[model samples]
Target: MKAELDLARAFALEEDGVTAIEYGLLAGLIAISIIAGATAIGGGLNQFFTGVGNWFSGITVP
Candidate 1:
């Protein structure tokens, strides 16, 4: 009974699991932010390139 109580107390005091979960959540959020930023930048670059291409296509050379 004493050993069981000690084991229960140790389990209750453990923080490693909680710390690992917190780190995992933080990493997931960082990854999501990076993906969102990259997507936005990629869309803007595509539009800019398309506009430049259209503008160049309108020019004629003798």
Candidate 2:
């Protein structure tokens, strides 16, 4: 019975599962942040370039 208790205690302290879960969560958060940042920047930059290209198109009407 004592050996069984020792084995159970060892199992409880095992770090492999906890480490993997932490790494997985970190990776997921990083991916979400990157996507969010790109979307925030992409919309504004797209419009700025579109207007610039139009300005140089020489299609203005007086």
Candidate 3:
């Protein structure tokens, strides 16, 4: 019984659990920010590059 209680106490270490959760949340936030920024700028960047390519193709720059 004492061993079981000790094991439970170890498992219940609040600092470890909190740290794990904090890191997980931080990673999640970072990933979401990357996705959001990519989505917001992806199309415009692609369009600008495509336009530049067309401009260099001796065709009118649209």
Q: Pick the candidate with the highest TM-score.
A: 1
Better of 1 and 2 by TM-score: 1
Give the candidate order by descending TM-score.
1, 2, 3
- Candidate 2, residue 12: Cα displacement in angstroms equals 0.5
Model 3 agreement with the true structure over 1-62: per-residue lDDT tens digits: 99999999988875877989999999999999999999989989999999999888886665
Q: Ten-residue segment with the worst summed lDDT in candidate 3? A: 53-62
State the C-alpha lDDT per candidate: 1.00, 0.96, 0.92
Q: Which pairs of residues clash in candidate 2, taking residues 3 or more apart in a chain or in different chains?
A: none
- List, residue by residue over 1-62, the lDDT tens digit for candidate 2: 99999999999999999999999999999999999999999999999999999888967777
- Candidate 1 ranges with C-alpha deviation above 4 Å: none
Question: Which pairs of residues collide in candidate 1?
Answer: none
What would the TM-scores of all predictions be?
A: 0.87, 0.83, 0.60
Ranking by lDDT: 1, 2, 3
Q: Poorest 10 consecutive residues of model 2 by lDDT?
A: 53-62
